[model samples]
Structure formats: C-alpha cells, structure tokens
Target: MERSHDGYDLFSPEFRADPNAHWAAMRQAGCPVAHSDKWGGSFMPVAYDDIRDIARDGARFSSRAIEVAGPLEAAGGLYLPPLTSDPPEHKPHRGVLMPYFLPARIAEFEPFVREKARKLAEELAERGGGDVVTDFAQHLTIAVLTKMLGVPPGEQFTDWMIRMIRVGPKDQAVRAEAIHEILGYLGGLLDEREVEPRDDLISYLAAADIEGEPLSRKHKIGAAFLVLIAGADTTWSAISASLWHLALHEEDRKRLVADPSLLDTTSEEFLRVYAPVSVARLATQDVELHGRSVAAGERVLLAFGAANRDPEVFEEPDKIMIDRKRNRHLTFGSGEHRCLGSNLARLELRITLEEWLRVMPDFRLVDPDGVTWSGGQTRGPERVDFEVVR
Candidate 1:
C-alpha cells in the first residue's frame, strides 16, 4: 500500500517467494481492488469471494486478455478457443473441446500415465540423484501431452514451450517470437495430420465437427495450442512442487509411502497447497467488489492461489496437511472457466508420487537452501536435487 507503483507486482521476487504473506498483507490493507500498471493497468482481487466473483460473471468480465494479446493479436492471430472466447460463443468452442477432457476420457489415459511415471521414476531411482523438475517432471508432462495429441516428440516443441511459458510472462519480445515459432510448428503438424491421421487428439481435431462441418483451421490450431500450453507447464509445476514438499516433509512422505491409497486425498491436498495457476481477465463493465470500484475494461489478475490460502477458507492455510479433510480450495478457477486439465493433472500427480515412493522409498534434499523455484505465471521447483536411498 505504501509502494509508489499503482498496484502490487505479481512478478516480484519477494511476492513469488511468499505470496501468502503478501496476500495476507493485502487483505489486511483492506483494499481488495489492488491496482498495478504492469499489464496495462490491472486490478488484483485478493479475497476468495472477490476472485471467484470476477471469474463467475462472464457478463461482467471478458477473457480476451487471459493470455498475451499485445503481439499475439493480429490478423489471423492465435485465438485461444474456448478460454479466450466469452459466454454464448464460449459455449460451442468449449463444447467441441470438452469431450476429450471428460473424466471418463481421461480415465483411458491412466495406464499410460502410470507407465510413463513408472519408467521415469525407475530411471531417476537408478541414478539416485536428480533434479525433480528437469529429470522427472519435464519428461512425464511432455510425453503425456505429446501422446494425448498423437504427435511425435521434438526438442523444439518442449524447449520452446518452457521458454514461451516462463519467458512470455516476463519478456514480450521473446514471448512474441516464441508464439510465432509455436504457431508455425503447429501449422506444419496440422499438415502432417492431414495425410497420416492417427488415433490421437491431433487427428481428432483435424476431423472434429461443429455446426455440421469440419472445424476451421483457426479452431484446430487454437484447440491444439490450448492443450499444449495449458497441459505442459501446469501439470509439471504441480507434480514438481508436490515432490519438493515430500522431500522436505518426511512424516507426510512416510504416511503416503506406507499407504498408497491415501494418494487420493493426498493429491487433492497437494493441489490445495501447491496449486499453480493465475488467470487474467478484462472487466466488461464497472463493478463494485469488496467495497472497491473496478472500472470497465480494467485488467484483473485472479490470484486463485491467494484465494486458496485465505485464512477464512482453510485453517493454517500456509501449512500443508497431507491428510487435510474438506479443503475447498480454488486451485482451479471457479465457474465454467475452471481448468479442463484438472483430471489429467490429478492423475499425473498421484501416479508420479506413487511411482516415486514405490521406487525411492527414502529421499531428502541434497541442499535445502539450494532448491530453486520458478515464479510469475506458474510456480514450482525449477530444480530440486534429491539424495535417494533406493
């Protein structure tokens, strides 16, 4: 509140390291409509109700700016399909994309998830020392997404994905370049899918229908683009953060390693604790929230993580309770815009923890102070060195 800046800097190192403290301070500051000029003058709603209110009212908040728009918006530029579209229009695109992510459909991929996690865990166990982020999280996520899309793996895809996700939030020029490259690559892949169709998301999108005709090229690209960008960073971050917690908390680790069945509840607890997503929106009309006025066309950063940590919502919200019951955290945003990848993400986290504990029953951080974490758009352990006893 004392800062010269218009609003809080979400990308600040201090905030990223201890966002809950900042959120608590913001709540204490008693101004829910905190303003910032970083994203062209945005407002961040700190309270859980305020965040969800902005998310749920599609009529009042537009999602056009949920993603980068400065450079990514141009003639035939990337349109983020269901997510970027609002209300009535949001329905059809979301409709076309939803079936693939349904719980039943995601269930079909569980075996694949377990196998990939198992193979990766075994490799990491053999090595007995590795960074969870690069060694395990990256491979499992990239492989899972690639398999789901029915596409071959390439260094460019994964490497640029990491760059685009991490850098895009900080450097617009680099972000634009990354977007251009990805769009071009996805365009080429669409060409390949044309002739050599396979039983995967790519092929399905190629032939997907809406309103009695095949999907438009833009729709195809957007849908595939959504899957890549959404699935890649988010899942990997959640998985890596969970591992980091386990490496530090032995009692919780021992409980889970002892009873793998606890993973069902444990996975939800991890999501509540290490939830890794922050969505943005533009106000469609002036609105009063938590006793503050947000003007029309204003940008709003919905800090779901903050809402998840609201003391009113969760007792000792800062503490990670592996067996915590009745946690209604909004790790996933509220309303129709809730993350479509939730089912897949949960499966990946559960399976990764299962396989890791099964293979390396005991492990600890090589250097507690040496663990590096990523911040900004998504948060997770960028690198975690574990000394494992296999």
Candidate 2:
C-alpha cells in the first residue's frame, strides 16, 4: 500500500529523505496539484500562489480537520482550538490566545528561551558532539513548552508529545493512547488551576472563556494540547533542520559565524529553505484548481514548504542565502490560520542559533549520509548527529 503521488511515493523513505527535490520535480513537470490516494485521497498544492489562495480561502478550505488522513474528527476529535477551529469559533479561540503570543508578550519569554538554548548548546559543546534533534533541539523545545504550561519539567511529557505529534498521526493505537494520556494530564492541571490559578497558559485557559461562557474542560485541555503538539515538534524540526543545514554547508555556516549580525536573515533563510509543517485543509465544495477538480471534502495538503521554494516566488529558491533580501516566505503559512506562535518561534530560533554558534561554531555532521527525517503533515530531520571540531 504505497502512498503514491504522481509517480512519487509520499510515504516512502526516499520522499521523506528529500521531499524538496521531489516537490521541485513535480513543480517543474507543470504539476501544480499532485494527487495521492493515500489517506483516503488528498491533493498537494505546490505553487506559492495556489497554496496561498487555498490557505486564505477558509470558506472553501475548512481547518476543522487538518490531517492528510482526512478530517480531525475522524481521529477521535481532540478539539485543539484555534488550529483546529474554523471561522467564528476560530476568531474567538484565536482572540483569547492572541495576547499570549503577541510580540510584546512573546518577548517576555526571551530570557527563558535564551537560558534554555545556552544550557543545551553548552551541554552539546561539552560532549564535543551529539544528535542535534534529541540532545539539543527537542530538549530545548520541550523545556520551553513545560515552562509555558507551568508544568514540572519531565521526560514523560516529551515522550508523550513526540509520540502524539510525530508517531501518533500514523498509528491509531498510539494516537488514541497518547491523546488519552495528554487529555488526562492536562485535565488534572486545569482542575488545579480552577481552584488555585497560576501565571501560566493552563491557568489562563482554565479561567478563560469564549464569548461570555467559561470554556469547557475539553476546550481547555485541547488548547493546552495544541500548545504541546504545535509548540514541540514544529520548532524542534525547524531548529534541527537549521543545524543540519549548517552542519553540511561549511561555507554558509562559516559566513554566519564570521558575521553575527547576519543571524536575523540567516534564521529566516533557514526557515524558508527548511520550512517544516505542511498543513491539510478539507475542501468545502467542488473546485477546479489548475484545471484539476477537487470535490468537496477532499483533503488538500497545503505544501507551504514547497510554496516557499517556488522559483516563481523565490529567486534561486533552493539556495540558502543568509542575506536573501525581501524574503517573504510563507513558512508561517498565510491567512487567518497562520501560525499563532510565529513570533515566539522566531525568538526561540534566533536565540537557539545565537547561543549554539557562540558555543559550538565549529560543529559539523557526524555523517552526512546518516541524518534521518520524518515526513507527513510535518517533515524534519529525526536525528542530526553533529561533532564539534576542537
């Protein structure tokens, strides 16, 4: 049962290894929308404008079920608001949570983010090398998430999140178990916050409401669950991919190292080149896209990564230009459902790179051929083994 897409197998190891190349081929072949029968049936819009339009047209593309495997409700309906909510519901959920992620509020988390990044980079430097994904990126992401949720730092949270976000999507049993565990965990925390509030997201959600009514327990847990799922792997993937890129490309890495001022552009370029997270949107009605018909209810994989790399939009799209000017890549996606955590994500990424380069500027891949990647809704290096040059 290969998840084939126009001669390419989306679920195959080869595609996961280098999806960008496959996508480039597809785009070059004049294929704007690549169809795949996997996950019941789905479409991937490769071009920038098409993806942008699809993302913006919420009426035609519902966000309620954002999985390539069809609707979110089919997967036990976890109800992660904002990300999973659509239209009117989306506005309120997004509004309530918006203040937390606003630039000013996100800046408040900078010291904490910087502290975690420094510690992780120092540990890796001390070890003279390590898997960037596990040892540094993933660890740093989970630590921040725990701090944001006001939960005690624990390895179990990391494990559960990894399973839920990465592994669970492809496995029903794992998905169900992980969802149950996460809901239960957050439910208890919500209960605690109800009586004795804290200065954390969970407490805010516990007390917060949509319109005038207080949010249901399920909604509270779902919001927190969104933070765990969205907050963990996506940033981890971006960070790991950035490190992986630098580990292989010495010249680019060296240039950034020589000029610390180039970090802002460098980070954005990395995000553009290695943009992780391709979201799914269900068609609300029959539509003709690039002369291809998409019936209502069919899932469309909004390939933002592919869109970012569209040559029509980005000159020398594949090349990672640290100082690429006017780089308005859609890595954060587009329209109303654009990533709520973009500001925070950018801060974490910049701080991660800044701190890592400060401590381990001379690091490279342990084995260029040995890096691993995971692909589906979101794609990134699963393991990026690096070795610091002494």
Candidate 3:
C-alpha cells in the first residue's frame, strides 16, 4: 500500500521501520527527488546509480555540513567531524585518522574483539537467551570503541561514554543537554591526555599536526565524539541486523557454520543488506541525474539502504545470499568519504559472528512484535530479544 505525496511523512515510525516499499513507490511515481522541509529541504534518492554517482563526485555534491542541516546544524561541533567536511579541509584530518583504522591496526586488536565477543556470547548462553541488540551488540561495540580510545573497558568512564554517544534523533532538548555534558567531559579527558599521552586514537589526534600546529581543543573533542558515535552506533546496528538475519535464516546459519571459510563473504553480504548509516548529501550545483534535475544547494539523501537493495545492481536484491561473489555494496559508502573504520567494523563483525554461532548455534526471536527500531539519520533495531536453545 502506498500513500499520496501529502500523506508521506519521512520521519514517521512506519517509514523508519521499512522504507524500501516507500522508496520503490516514489521511484515509480516519477518523483526521484522526494523533499522534506523537516530535514532542511533534503531530497531522498531512491535509484542505485544516482547515489553512487553522487558519492563519487564530491565536488558536485559536496558533503560539507550540508547534510546535517535543520536542527542538527545548531549543534555544530556535536555532529560527526571530518565526515561533515569536504575536499581539502576533510583531507588532513582524514589522512591522520586513516592509519589507526587500517586493516593491520584492526588485525592487532582482533584478539581483544574476539575475547569480548566470546565473553558476551558465553554470558548470553548461560542466560539461555538475550537481547542481542542491548546485551550483546551494544556492549561489544562500546567495549571495542572504548578500548581503541584507550578507555578501560567496563569502567565508569566507559559507561558514561556509551550513554553520551547513544544520543539519537529524539527530544532535541535532551539531546542538546547530553551533548553539552559530553563535550565538557571530553574536554577534561583531552586536557589529561595532553600531559600524559597514551597509545590510543585520542592521544594520536591530540598530538597530530595538521599544518605545523597541534590539533586544537575543539578539533580533539569533535574528532573524539565522531569516533565514539561512528565507531559505536553503526557497528552495533550492523552486528544486530546481521544477528537478526542469521536468526531468521537458519539455513544461512547452517551454511556458515558448515564452512567457516565463507565468513568473509558472509560478512560483506550482511553489510550489503543492512547498510546501517543512511547518510545524506547535498547538491552544490544544479545537476541532471537519470533525467531528474537537482537544483543548487538541494539536499539529496543517498538512501544507501535503498541503493544496496536496488534490483538493477543485485540479483535477487532482497534475498540474503551469504556467498555473493561480486557483492559491491555501499554500506561503508563510496569514493573519498568512504568509512575509515570499515576495516575495524569488519574485523569486529567477522569475529563476533564466528564466535557467537560457535557457542549458540540455534537461537530464535523471542517476540517479533516487541522488536523496536531507533529511527534517526542511521536506522537499526533498538532491541531484539531472542532465546538460545541450550
């Protein structure tokens, strides 16, 4: 069932739960540029090629704080740093942060990630079931992010950081209060790290020189916030979705369990289907795309989630095939602004899946109706309870 243009509410809970149907309907209606004033005049792109093209050409569709327009713009520094920037300004910081999230760096931390996953799985197994989203996924992601930032896992500081980073699209007043509190807290941490630097991403950024000068307090705080949120939320969502998929498809789980070698491909396939970060971009100048014209400064949401499921791109796009050979999904994104921490995310997901399946091979969704999704710029289940067959 499709609703008329006047009836479509982008921020509606129904839209958030399953947007693909709406996207398809919109695409068919000949209105590729679905506008929403709530998001500061942003347009949602439903086509596959258009999103890829827009992502590839940063100059034409500059990201630079253009996407986070509306209410989020006021909270300037609170938004994801470097990610909101484009080209030359985006390059220096991205370059400095790149090495830390490289595959080799993530490889070094694989043991730690595996241990966390095993412990979480073991705890859930003992309980005979658990909410994968809250108990397992969220905990695992927060643990890894805190570890990367040199924060001790399972500590008060970690707890604070996790709470601080979980701010999503909800009550603006509450979100702002949380942001202010977190910024102040992060400021103190930066000051301490300044005197006694550690071998962590935060310390590295604190000491990093963009052009003969060390990064400023705002830069450090902003970068740290971005890392915490990006590293935690998206990864947690991906893992949760992947777990949900596996639970629903026991045949897929059996296939993966039978041949552990397919882990890499399976991981990619999950990401392809469950692209967590539904990033929005803007058209810097008027551009024609697939017979549609986008005006200058017009916002275009590259429905990475929709694009991944584009029938033109993926064969049987809706189906979750674990062994997709040529799966080039835009989960991490495309072109220059592609995720820097994708390797780390992949490492964590790979290890988490391998370990979880080994311990609890048969798990069933407890109450499908009870499952809730946290709607925001990025979308994923809020709570997914399940029962493990011990």
Which one wins on lDDT?
2
Q: What overall lDDT, based on C-alpha atoms, would model 3 receive against the true structure?
A: 0.76
What are the per-residue Cα lDDT tens digits for candidate 3 across 290-362? 5556787666777788888888888998888899998989888888888888998999899999999999988
lDDT of 1 by residue, 319-370 (tens): 8887888888888888988888888898899889998898888998989887
lDDT of each: 0.80, 0.84, 0.76
Model 1 TM-score is 0.94
Clashing pairs in 3: none
Rank by lDDT, highest first.
2, 1, 3
Candidate 1: residue 209 Cα off by (Å): 1.7
> What is the lDDT, from 0 to 100, of the residue 363 in candidate 2?
84
Clashes of each: 1, 1, 0
RMSD values for the candidates in order, in angstroms, are 2.3, 2.4, 2.9
Question: What TM-score against the true fold does each predicted structure earn?
Answer: 0.94, 0.96, 0.91
Superior candidate under lDDT, 1 versus 2: 2
1 or 3, greater by TM-score? 1
Scored against the true structure, residue 41 in model 3 reaches a CA lDDT of: 57
In model 1, where do residues sit more than 4 Å from their true spots?
Answer: 1-6, 68-77
Residue pairs clashing in model 2 are 65-72
